[model samples]
Target: MENINEALGLLLVGLTTVFVILYLVGLIGNGVIYLTNRFVPEETMAKRKEIVKGKAKPTNPAKIAAVIAAVEAVTGGKGKIEKIDKIDKIEK
Candidate 1:
């Protein structure tokens, strides 16, 4: 039927238009992120010369990562570790 054909054509046109619009939005978002990163580079954190002072051995990166992950999980991603210090002894 001519009506059915016309409806199908309209549907196809609408879908194509939406897809093109979404694709353009995605492209623009990516372009903005790329431009921002390129123009305003993120600052790098300074590396510590000594993670532990006197008697304490160097800390393992895996342990640090696990601790950070645990803190994030506990705080629901609101926690941040500013500094880590070695505990010489624990009081009862």
Candidate 2:
């Protein structure tokens, strides 16, 4: 009876300690994020220049649109793609 009560008491204390620590960590993390977002200014990105090469094929606007659509769909319209670089095929 005494052993059982002691075990239950210890369990309760351990669980409460864990919950309180986790809650504090979450609060601190949220505070840090809020402070950074409030103080930091976002930078504007430069416009992409069209690349023209003698032998390279032209980039398709349709492909870029499709990729943007896919990303928006996956993020439920919250996803933002800053830049997308196309890899070139190389010959050995």
Candidate 3:
């Protein structure tokens, strides 16, 4: 009984020590991340948003020919493009 109690106590102590060490490591990591983000310059962290602005234009004949060729190749000449609609760009 004494040996069993001693083993249980050692197990509890080992688990508690590991938990405390892991908790401290997580806190330190979070603190480092917070400090780094707080001190970083905005220009260095700014990301560019690519915006394409253009009016709805007719599709080029060369592009249409290429699309028709690709579809024919994929479907063994069974596919056909009846109509092609131009998508207008939305301005934000």
Clashing pairs in 2: none
Ranked by lDDT from best down, the candidates are 2, 1, 3
Q: Report each candidate's C-alpha RMSD, comma-separated, in the order given.
A: 12.9, 12.8, 11.4
Quantify all predictions' global Cα lDDT against the true fold.
0.69, 0.69, 0.68
User: 1 or 3, which is superior by TM-score?
Assistant: 3
Q: Flag regions of model 2 displaced more than 4 Å.
A: 44-92
Question: What ordering of candidates by TM-score runs from best to worst?
Answer: 2, 3, 1
Please report how far candidate 1 places residue 79 from its true position, in Å: 19
**45-89: candidate 3 lDDT, tens digit per residue:** 552111122223343656656667888999999998765544223
User: TM-score of every model?
Assistant: 0.46, 0.47, 0.47
Error in Å for residue 30 of model 1: 0.6
